[model samples]
Structures are given as structure tokens and as C-alpha cells.
Target chain A: MAINKNSNGYIIIYTVVMVVIVGALLAFLATSLKGKQDANVLNEQKVSIMKAFGEADANFDGVVTMGRINGGEFTVVEKADQQAVFELLGNRKALGEATDNLPIFQMEKDGVVKYVLPIVGKGLWGDIWGYVSLQQTEDNIIITGIVMDHAGETPGLGAEIATAKVQDMFAGKALYDATGAFAVRMQKGGAKNEHQVDAITGGTKTCDGVNAMLETSIGKYESFLRGAEAEVEADTAAAEECTCGECCEEEIVEPINEEE
Target chain B: MKLSKNFTNPLAANNPVIVQILGICSALAVTVKLEPALVMGLSVTFVTAFSNLVMSLLRNGLPSRIRIIVQLVVIATLVIVVDQFLRAYMYDVSKQLSVYVGLIITNCIVMGRVEAFALGNKPWDSFVDGVANGLGYAFILVLVAFFREFFGSGSLLGFKILGDWYTPNALMLFPPMALIIIGCIIWVHRSINKDLQEK
Candidate 1:
């Protein structure tokens, strides 16, 4: 073959050889970094979970001590006899049927279990998600921490939802009442009580979305909380029987003749 | 060797985007913000200059049957190196650039130079040719980006250049503005350089 700068065959052979070399190099580099990349992703998830719990100051490397709600453990529970799946928004049967799944993390301390579950909802510009922890007693949920990010929202306005002050509002907020009615709401002007979370004035839509997300996400755990409460009552009853305390002794005395 | 007007001409007279109407795709896509445009300009410059140099050097020994393939191979190789370096160091910028950096392998500017000048010239002359042409491309891109970033975001290099009161024009962030800006540049360039006007 005549060698020429303009020849097509020369270019073909050169291209093939160059491509082979470059491809091999890229493959080697990718493989070498694969492990580190995977580890980074796992670390990020752990950090997100920790930050959600307001435990950002806790040492993440060492063994995490579980609190009353197992800070490290979470679970997914479905409401019994309810077709509506607990979701980030108010229960929508269609949306529930689509995902039909939830996550709950349990933090265990001295054999007691506390669970942190995640909440997801839509923000003004994009989707928002957060985590909330509940006590085994089913009395209320402590807003441990939250994380919010957006796709294309304005930087200073809607984006402020991710700020610390905004996320802090969720701490120690209750998800339900004695009647099992979900009362979580984002007040427009300001929160009325410690239990009510104040909405982001600039981010009204996002606040509404978050309010909806919490009701739906927490509502799904209704059945799980009921079961947990029942189990606790049974355990407490059994423990009381074993102890020869004043109450137990009185019960054993065959209810000293009511007339006397 | 006498410096043919062809060697220095494109830097201004036949500028790629502003004059020749080539490479406008990147000019619009990356110009939405300043930093990405700057990085994209430099990346293209590096690829163009080196690819031209390499192609000219091998022009003599290349087989007549496959010279174009060899040109593409050289351009593609240089592009990969640039892409890797960006990924290693400027990871955030690289992420923003995403697949656009890799798409440089197919940029018409690099291929056009190799075909037009590298095949006909000596390596040193070809290197200069590459630099001149690449600069011409960069000049247009920077001008477009300056306008886009300034009006669109009220900032430069992510710093707020416009005062607190200045509201950004959202339309500038989209790709359509790039085309309009490029058209304006061409109009101005042609108006000033009467010889460049279409007959």
C-alpha cells in the first residue's frame, strides 16, 4: 500500500491501535477505583442517616450506641386492613400500590427498640425526603434530623429548606395523638405549639409538600406501632406479676373482700 | 517559509463560530455559565493544537488508503487524555461537562484543521496553525459566555458580579440564547469586516 498522509487505510490502522491502547488504560483505571467508589457511596448513606437523626456530632466511625429507638436500625411496616400504603403524601391508594414498600430503622438500647423511618415528598421544584424516629411506646415521634435537596429550585429561596434552622424545626415533633389521628402539619405563619412545626414562609409549597409527606410516611407505621404497643403492654404486665411489689401483692391477696 | 495568510487568517477573519459558522453546538451548550465555557474552550484548544501537531508529523508516513482514520485516531487519543486529566483533577467541572467532554472527540474543529492544514504542512507550521485556529474558536466562545453568564445568572465564576438587586434573566440559561448570541456576533463581525459579507 502506498503510504500517504491523505490515505484512508493508514488512518484505519492507526485508529485501531490507538483505540485499543486507550480502552485498556481506561479499563484499568476504572477497576482500580471501583472499590473506593463503592465505599464512598456507603459512607455517604451512613452520614445521611446520622445527620437525619440530629446526631451529626456523634462519632460515625466507632460502634454506634443504640438509643431508646435503635438509632442504627430501621424497619418498614404496613398498616393492617388499610389498602392505602403509607407514602410521603397523604395516603393515595394508587401511589401505595405502585411502591407498596417502606423503610424503618431501629436503634436498640438495653433491649428496647426505637425506630427511625424515612419520609419522601415533592418540593416546589423537585422531590424531598427526610427521616423521623419514634418511641416503642407509640406515644409520639421525635424529629431527629432531616435532609432536603432539590433539582432546579432557586438558590436562595426554595433551596433554604435544606438549611439547618429549617430542618431543626422537625426535632421532637409528634406524629400522632391519643386518638391515633395524625396531627402533623406545617403552620403557614408560625407553629402554634412545640408539637407543631413552623412552615418555611418563603417555601410554602415545599412546606405543604413536606407536611403531606410526613402524614403519609408515618401513617404507614400505624399497624406496626399498634403491635409494638401491645407487645410492650404484655411485657410490662408479665414483669409486674414477677415482682412481689405492693400492687402485685394486693392482686394476689384475692382482692380483700370488697365490702371490707 | 513565507507565512501564508491562511496560517494567520482564521484567528479573526474566518473565525470558526463567529465567521465560519462551525462548532456552534458547544458554543451554546457550555456557554450557559462562564466556568464551563472556559474549561470547554481550553479543552478544545488543547485537543485541536495537539491533534494537528501529531497529524502533521505522521502525514508523511501514513498509508494513503487510511489517512483519515489515522487523523481521527490521533484526535480521539488526545481527547481521551484531556478527559482523563479533567476527571482526575477537575472532577466537579468534569461532572458538569458530563458527556460533552467526550463528545469533543467528534468536534468538527479538530477534524477540519487536520484535514485542511495538517495534511499539507510541516509539523511546526501545523502546530501554529492549530493554536491560531483554536484561539479563534476560544475567542468567540468566551465572548458568548460573558454575555450569557452576566445577564443570565448575575454572576461570574460563581461569584455574584451583579449587585444584590440584579435579577438574572432566566432565558439566558437555556440553549436558545446561545444561537441568538452567535447570530449577533456573526452579524457584527460581518458588518465590521465588509470583505466577510456574503456576496
Candidate 2:
């Protein structure tokens, strides 16, 4: 076979044609898979939140439903009075925005309304975010669930932080002391108290990062919490009628002020 | 046409990594984990075979002056197709493979086979040659990964093949081990096949 000595123009044309063909093909494939990719990400978020809350049968399949939280919707209630509903927040994608106007869920079960605050922070290799439901008093809080993910961390070490055993330790752990200061810490050696979490053996840096993240991330919500508490107090004082035992006791002494 | 010489030559005698010293970077990076190594090997095999076939088909029409450019364009196109297929169907594996999948474009074995064999041979022969060379590359990778994953983490493809008593050596997962293993493989392969010795 005689080898054809082709001109430079022919080579350039061939290269351009090949580039266009391949580029077009890849573009089509990427467009087709974009939906599936987004769904996978959403599913992963749900699975992380469920795992953090120690919920059973949490599959990372990205179908949104009322029963499943999936980082999309969540119910918040006050710790003081579990019966009161504070708020119901939906469409959580807006919660991660830079705006100060957070999507807060409020509901009234008994009489008090509580504020549900969402927190986001960075883990060792990726992002770790969670939602903390606080009572109107802003004293006691419950970690509804946490979602942790990593871009690329050492598997079995840093990645293990996403597992159930590590995340479950934060379920009822109080973020503040009686003095109302952030005292939440991950115990490096081992957790001595119920509030402390045991660190993974080889994930010391990751553990410390989680601790620092929670502190800084949760600290931002302090103002919103204080505002909610103040609202609750004002509501109680403004009520004309009181059906509670304390209010009934005050009713009996109403005539004594007139004699004085 | 005799098939034995074409098939066996690449497996050991003209092994790409040891003898030809091509495509060593991926062998080191992906070998740390068996799963990724397997995926990378399969991907290389697919890319090499098809690229060679395509190159062989166009060899007659390909201008001598731009042959190298044409070969690269063909190989790169195949690599992109493989990458897209992996991403679409096997998203998790694709993520784990990461940039290594894209790096397939630079893997020397594909380009070398195209220039050396595909450009000069018929399409059928080029395809076979591509497969043989890809298998040869994969053979070395699997061997290196077997030892690396076995001793590095006391696991095979993430399964605990070795019991708890066998303490894993962390150094095995490092890239240096791949170099040493490839060197040892070369030493053993050369010792057994005296004809492969450099003049």
C-alpha cells in the first residue's frame, strides 16, 4: 500500500472533525445523565440525615415524600413542651443560601412556638450539615438529624464518621451548659459524659474538625434563638386569660389590691 | 495466520510495563485499590482495542505527515466515549476512578500500539494486537494489585481475604510499592525469559 503524503490542511480538517464528533457525543451523554446525577446527590443527602438520626431503614433513594425528611422538610417542636409545634419548614435548598432570612419552621401544639434552625459546616474531606430543633426558651435542643459527606477522605477512617454509631452519639447531646455557653465537644480518648461523643480511633483530625464545625456553625443561630425566646415570653405576658394553675392562683388574690 | 505468537508475546516477552515501560502512572495510582484497578484495566482494554481497530481502518487514508495527530485524535475520542459510558451507567465507580478515567487518554500503551502495530497492520490484526497488549498491561496490574491489596489492607476487592491476624502493611498502598512490585515483576519475568534480556 502506497502511503499518501497528505497536506497539512487535510490533517487539520480531520482533527477538527474528530474533535467536533467526540465533543457532541460527550455533550449529549452529559445532558442525558444530569437528571440522574442530581437525584443521586439528593438521595445521598437523605441517607446521611437518616443515618445521623439513627433512623432505621434509611435508604438513599431520592424520592421525596411527606414521611421522609430527606433534607427537604422537617418538623420542629419545643423541648420544654413536647406537645407544642413550632414550625414546619419546607424546600431546604434555600436554607443553604447566604441570606440571613433563614427558612424557620414554627408550630403551636400547646401554646409555645419553637424555632428549628439548620446548621451547615465543613468536615474533614467534605461538608457536614445538620438541623437543631430548639425549645422556645432556647435552653434544651435536640439534633433532628445530621448529613455528612466527603469529597475524598480516607475510607474506613474519616469516612467512618458518617456511619450510624458515630452520628447517634449526638441525638440528645446538649449543645449548651446551664450557664448557656456552647460546651459541646467530641471526646478524643473516650466520651466520659452523655453529652460527649467518642472519637474514631485514627480520625483525630476529622473528629476535631467536626467539633470546631459544630461550634462555629451552630453559634450563628444564637440570635435567632434569642429572638424566638423573647417572642415566647412576650406572648405569655400579653395573654388576658390564663387557664394554668399559676394563673388560677393569681386570680384568687385579685380583690386584695382594691382594699389596700 | 498464527495466533499463539501474537497472543503470548504481549503477556510476558514484550510486556508493556516491564519490557516496553509504557502506562506506568495509572498502574501505580489505581493499583492501591483493587476495584479501581480492575475498572481501569477494563477501560484501557476497551479503549486500546477499539482505538487500534479505528486507526487500522483509517491507516490507508491517513496522510503520513499527520499520522500521529490522527492516531491521537482517535485514541482520545475512544477514551471520552469510555469515560461517558462509565459516568452514565456506573456513576459511583466513575467517581471513584476520578481523573484516572480521563488520564486514559495519555496512557502510553494505547498510543504505542496505534503507532507501532495499528498503523502498519490490517484492521483484524490490529484489533487482536490491541487486545493482546491491553491484556498484557492488565495482567501486570492485576498481579501488582493482588499483592498490594492483599498486604496493603489485608483485603481483596474490599473483601477480607486474609484473616484478622494478618496485620496489613500500610506502605503497600503507597505508589512506591507499585514501582517496587513492577520492578520485581520485571526481574522475575526477565529471569524466566532469557530472550527478553536487553542486549
What DockQ does each listed candidate score? 0.20, 0.32
Error of 1 at B24 (Å): 0.8
Per-residue lDDT tens digits for candidate 2, residues A89-137, read 2232344442443344342335644334445555566555555444444
Q: lDDT of each prediction vs. the true structure? A: 0.67, 0.67
Query: In model 2 chain A, where is the ten-residue run with the lowest total lDDT?
Result: A81-90
Candidate 2 residue spans exceeding 4 A from truth: A1-5, A59-147, A154-260, B64-68
User: By summed lDDT, which 10 consecutive residues of candidate 1 chain A come out lowest?
Assistant: A81-90
Q: What count of clashes does model 1 give?
A: 31
Models 1 onward score TM values of: 0.59, 0.68
Candidate 1: tens digits of C-alpha lDDT, residues B44-120: 98888899898898777766566677777678778877776776667557756766798888778889999988889
CA deviation > 4 Å runs, candidate 1: A1-260, B1-8
Candidate 2 interface CA RMSD, Å: 3.0
Worst 10-residue lDDT window for candidate 1 chain B reads B1-10
lDDT of 2 by residue, B1-199 (tens): 4567877788788889899999998898888768878888889999999999999998877788777777777887788888777766787788677678888999999999999988889898889888989999888898899899899878898888889799878778667889999999999988998987779
